[model samples]
Target chain A: MQHTISVLVKNEAGALSRMTNLFSARGYNIESLTVSTTLDTKYARATIVVTHCDDSVIEQILKQLHKLIPVIKVCDLTPENSTTLELVFIKVDSKNEVGELLKIAEAFGVKVIDVSPKTYTLQAVCNEKQLKSLVELLRPIGIKDIVRSGAVSINVKSE
Target chain B: MTNKIITKELTGSQVFLECLKNEGVDTIFGYPGGVILGIYEAFYHEKKIKHYLVRHEQAAIHAAEGYARVTGKCGVAIVTSGPGATNTITGIANAYLDGHPLVVFTGQVSASLIGNDAFQEADIVGITRSCSKHNYLVKDIKDLARVIKEAFYIANTGKKGPVVIDLAKNVLDAKIEFEYPKEVDLEGYNPTYKGNPKQISKALQLLCNAKRPAIISGGGVLSSEASEELTELAKLLNVPVATTLMGIGTYPMNDQMALGMLGMHGNYWANYAISNCDVLFSIGTRFNDRITGPSKEFAKNAQIIHIDIDPCSISKNVTANIPIVGDAKIVLQAMLEEFKAKNYEINKENKREWFEQIEEWKKQRVIPEIQSEKLHVHTVLEQIYEYTKEYEPIVATEVGQHQMWTAQAFNFTKPRKLLTSGGLGTMGFGFPAAMGACLADKNRLVLNIAGDGSIQMNIQELATCVEYNLPVKVMIMNNGYLGMVRQWQEKLFDRHYSETKISGPDFVKVAEAYGAKGIRIKKKEEIIPALKEAIEYQGPVFLDFIVEPFEMVYPWVLAGTPIDKVILSRKE
Candidate 1:
């Protein structure tokens, strides 16, 4: 199981290390993690995708996070209960299939950000499932480079 | 008194001292270095605060923890940057896990040298973030006073734990208008001291209905000073009380309702009761794995009511049917009051039947009486207890078999009488902690009951104790091995000891070198005289008791097993 967790913490030095240390020390797995300053630069919102933890373990992990002084808040955003988006940029070798690459990008609502005779850099903003599909479709053409923004999440209700 | 407002200017160092004084701190455990020179210089002119210079940074923090445990006040420790700050990590983590109220001040490199990795610079705040309950890095000189005040406030209040304040070298020298905050408001840290009324009602109802009710009191009961209420409540309901290692002094050992200790190395009768009880009312304990073996099988027949200050602790390891998140003192007091209001009293006749059943279980296995040629560890501990029983000594211990034996042998009737590293099980905590306890109250007898392996861990603290003239009796039970690990090897590993065998320096010479009295007893007959001589001495006394090498803690419970399935004797 995977859970998208949004943690708000004080923007202090080593806050990220402290959060990540808790996960590693407790043996929880972090699939992907992304952090950025919230509205107030004094605080940061860390969007982390934790995998292989059941609901109870996830709850316990969140409780442990709450014990840390720097952590202000922890929220678990399940797929059905929240909205999430991930931005990914994939550079595919488009030596001869430039037209096919553009068609695939258009179908997935992706933009062809950059292009050269040898490669096509495509960017896509989508949910986790759609992002996986886009990567699978581009793999045959050959993926030269790929980078993901992880996932930023918010609950449907203001909780 | 007239209302007069006088404004004064002071350096951050001066403000730091003033804030501690305002908090009624009379002593500090510390070490001096380059980054902390300003604070040290300020201390040179001070008369109100006494500073005990420790050998190592870790000892300073452990000493503070010992002081805090005895006095029920936040202990303060100060050390310098980089290595000095890093050395306190183990001690800080020990205090954090065991819930000690400690405030540690680590001198940081100047604000300019912070990120540049200049001489003696370390990200101390970053290093200690995971262990400390809360930490602060003072960037502005003006925030120093407020930070110090808040550090003390947070360290001592609401389920106390260690807090760290990283003082930049420049901030200590900077001049600032200082005004300490009278109060702190942290939105994220509002602890519920009062238990929910509805939950309390439901818990009482369950207890009244339960035919086989038992209580497992933990360290929280001691921390909150709720032992009196706990005792009263146990008596009123006729519920037998079993304590954890940390809960040694939370209930009087003389009480009939007392089932000494429970879990691994716990009493057979106590573990039996916990396993068979229908209603398990746990107070102030986290239900650690050691206490609740095989979480699923633990208290299988019981409906549990857990009362604790930390909400996360409830249903953490074991499920709690009724969870009341509140301070043990406040919550216990509320429960007692509610019990009184309801006037639902236990009939003595019915309670006697329950006691009779527990007594029948207790007689099932008798503690083996060994008539061995070598001095037994239990005999040595029993003599120490017998000699010091009248004095009502405050006992602190290093982690191992001796720790468990001391917990079983010593009789503690009140809270704060015994301090040990329970959660973290740090080996070197006893001696320095006893130094702290002695320093906290010179009149009371403080004993550091240790093992040969553990005493050597913080052996350097002997100098500090001798220098301060703190009469902390260090009783070392020398068994020539790491007894606990050896026990496990003998049981589960087919007796392949593998590095468990250990030796130590001549403790008598070591004590003499540190300018303290030393006594050695090889024969069982020498135990009483040696203990008496150590007690009568005016300074720190290090007593070495050479005991049987293979003596193990009995009634052991292996991990992942049922609590009731305990190995009663050496033969299994």
Candidate 2:
């Protein structure tokens, strides 16, 4: 099972490394992680994606995150109770992707962020399923490069 | 000028000592170096604080850990930057894993030269980031007082672990107001002290309803000083009580209800009880892999109700049916109250069948027998226990076969009597810890049971002990090998001893070279006399007891094996 956990931590030096070091120290898996300063400036939010974890392991990860001194809060965010978004960018051969790629991008609700002579970059910010399917559609067009912002989330109940 | 706030200005070093004094700390275990000279200079006029300079930076922290274990006070250690700071990492990790309260200070390069890699500078805060409960890098003189206060508070409170404070050299020379923080206010830190009343009641209900309930205690109970509460609860309920190595001496091993310890290398009956009991009520133990052989197979028939101070530890290894996050002492008190409300009584008939079953398993329990005419580790431990039991001595152990033998053979009736590194299993911890233990309480006897392979790790501490006049008695079981590793290779690796065989300097000569008493005992008849002389000696003494080289710790359960599935079938 894959679980997404968000940790709110005090904005300080080595705060993110604490999270990474903790995962490594406890032998916990981290598939993807994205960290950035929050709007509050004093705090930062880290979204960590862990795979092949049981419910008990996820519970421990959350509890251990809370144990970090700089951590203000930690929550396990599931797709059902939270709104998640991952911004992905995929670049492909512009000449070959000029016509059908735009059509496929339109169908998948992705934006053509850059269209240069050599490459065209497609962008999408959606939940995991939509992002995966969109990336698959672009793969046949000969992808040149790819980048993902991992996953960010907001608890719906909090709103 | 009318709205101005004024405070007395003092140098950074003055504030440093003042903060420790304000925190009620009078002793410092540390060493001096170029980067830490400012703080060392302040010690010249320091009347309240006494500093014990150790031979190595690592020994300083271990000594502090030993001090903390005995006194229930946060251990304080200070060391210089770079190599000096790096040396203490092992001790810091040991304290972190064992949950000892230690506040370690490491001097760093000037704040401006922090990332520039200046001479003798290391990012110790980042180095100890994961191992320490919390850490701080004092970039400004103004933040010094509050950081020190918070370091002390964080180390001593909640789960009780090490905290590191990396100080820049320039900051120590800078001027700051000498007002120590009156209180620590960490926004992200608040520990749960009182257990939920509903959860306590529910757990008590489960205990009352179960016919075969047992209590497994761990270091958290020792940390919380909840032995009295745990004793009462176990006695009143007439439930069998087993302890983890960290919880040894918390519940008297000789108690009829006491099943000794339960885990790898634990009591056979105790492990059997843990395997078969229906209601497993664990207090203060984290259920680490050492205690629970295979998480899935451990206590398969039991519904575990775990009470721990750290929430992260509750279900980290094994799932807890009822998890209560609070101080052990507080939760035990609440459980006691809940037990009273439920009119709990000692109804022996209800658990008569369970008791009979445990007794049956107890019949298979293994004891250390005099296998050969050669001196045995158990015999030495038993004789030492007999001689030292009257003083209520504190026993520290270097990790090896001797450590396990001491853990199983010695009977400790009080919490904090045994100070071995349970989680980290550190080898060199025993001697320095014994030194720290003696300094913590000068009157009580302090003993370090060591192995030939382990005693050499921190043998340099003999100088520190002799200089300070700390009468720390070190009994090295001279087995001529790393007994634990040798046992593993002998059993699992086709009787291939490999590199487990090791030789060391003559410990008695080494002790005497460091100006401490040294005694060598080769015959069984000399054990009593040597121990008496060492105990009577006014300074540090090292007793090298030559013992059988092939003895192994029994009742050992292989990792991932069921606790009841004892391999090797000792003395069958």
Candidate 3:
């Protein structure tokens, strides 16, 4: 099962590498990772979305993470009933299929964030599956560029 | 009187020097670089502190580890940021895994340009976080003195491991009031120092009752410098002693009851003893997979009594019937007293017969028969052992068949003398670690028995040895293949050799290239003479012995197999 993990770590050098090493060493695939400074100046919050691992494996990973001196805590945000979204910006050729692209964008509730003479940048805020479908549909019309922000998640209820 | 005032503007380099001196650090190993020029300027004038310019930052870290391992003191290293810091990653990890105390200082870009992607600003603290027990980033100049003191204390205390302090260029330049904190207040860093007396008494009772009892010692005993206590306990209990690869030198290898190494590549007698014993007492060792074979089948009939310094390591791998968590030195000392108080007598019912059986097994399987004209790995170990028989020199080795051979062949009667990277199994650990060990004990001869692949990993340390004029003998078992991996492939993969064969430059030439005396020996008769010549050489000397590639160390127990089910050489 795919699970979203939130890790609170000391804000220090090589922290990211350490996290990546932990995952890679155990043969765990990191589907997406987002890091930012937390409310505390001395700590950083990392939200990592991983896939196809059982609850026991996820618990093992968290236990291993706790073993690291810098890691303060690790939380599985999936169980907390949280809000999550993945951001993607894709540019497509708009000269020939402007109406068709606009219709598809309206159907998915995506916004045209940027526009050039021959390109239209569509911005979408959705889950990973929806993002994948959007990319697949736009591939027929020719996608000039695609940039994904992976995934960022937060719990709806405060701790 | 009111107008009298003094002013001095000191750079970060001056602060670094003052901070080190304040922390009572006597020596440091580092190499100067473009980013570390300011620190070098301060180092130039610091006559009170001795600094050795190592060939590489990695060697510098290992050198520190050597100094720390022997003296039980904090080893210190200084390096420039970016690649310089990154180069020491493996050494740091090795020390971290082995639980050695080390303090590393790296030069970072000035505070203003830290995130600007400036030259030599590679986020060293971030790079070393996973490898280090703890790390600090000196953002303010005022924090330098306190941070340096804390780094040393933290690295040397509790569960000892490497700790890094990344100093910003500006922090080294900015001057502030200097004061060193005498104590550290860490809530999460408490190490267990006292073993439970009840548990110790129970373990002693078990030892007294079992006719066939064995003590399996590991590297933790060496780290705690408790070999004396361990030896005393084993003798009092009248039990045979076996060691893991990491625990090589804990008990005198020549001792009558000593069964060299126990595990996959361990001695047959040791494996037999472990399988037949009624009680197994493990001390200062983490029963690694290589040592235990199949966890479920290992010592199935024996009751396990585990004693360790780290609580987390007590039952982390193998379940212990009696878990005593504390410092090895303290626990062993306590056990000795308890044994004396109880006046325990050795059980003699089956003890004599068991010992005789073990000795027979050793006579039959421990002694290797090398019939080939080519120099075998066992032959090299025997030659080295013969040469160093009187001295019992500190022998360090890299990860390979050579490492196993050294562990089995060499009689390490003294604890903390056989220094090798066991938990990490680092390839390039020998040369540099030997250099460190030699530096730690100037009177003792340090021998680095390394494989061709493992030697090339840290061959650059020869320059450091030459610079220090340290006499460290480098014996290379040139099998021209990744011996261990190849052995596994040959036995398990039906001899389908993929990328195990090593095709590279000659090791003798490579050793000479590093400004060290080198000798190449192809004849079997020349092994002793070459070893003697290398040992006699004043400075560092490398002897490359071209060994047979397919010769596998025997009495092997495949992973997950019981010790009794070992596949002997004749079976192969």
| DockQ leader | 2
Q: Chain B alone, TM-score of each model?
A: 0.97, 0.98, 0.93
In angstroms, the error of model 1 at B462 is 1.7
lDDT of 1 by residue, B1-572 (tens): 76776678788899899899999999999999999999999999999999999999999999999999999999999999989999999999999899989999999998988899888888888788778888989978988887888788788777789999999988999987777788875645667799999999999988987888999999999889999999999988879999998888899988888998999888888999999999999999999898899999999999999999987798879989999999999988998999988777566665566778899888856475575688888888888899899999899999999999899889788889898999999999999999999988789999999999999899999999888899999999998999899989988999999999999999999999989999999998898888889888999999988888887788788988998998878877
Tens-place lDDT per residue, model 2, A9-88, is: 99988889989999998899998899999999999999999998888788888888888888999989987899888898
Itemize residue pairs with steric clashes in candidate 3: A13-B125, A13-B126, A14-B126, A14-B127, B11-B173, B12-B172, B12-B173, B252-B413
Error of 2 at B131 (Å): 1.6
As a whole number from 0 to 100, the lDDT of residue B185 in candidate 3 is 54
Instruction: List per-prediction Cα lDDT, in the order shown.
Output: 0.89, 0.90, 0.82
Tens-place lDDT digits, model 2, residues B507-553: 88888789998999988899999999998889899999989988778
Q: What's the TM-score of every candidate structure?
A: 0.95, 0.96, 0.79
Q: How accurate locally is residue A6 in candidate 2, as Cα lDDT from 0 to 100? A: 90
Off by over 4 Å in 1: B1-8, B343-353, B369-371
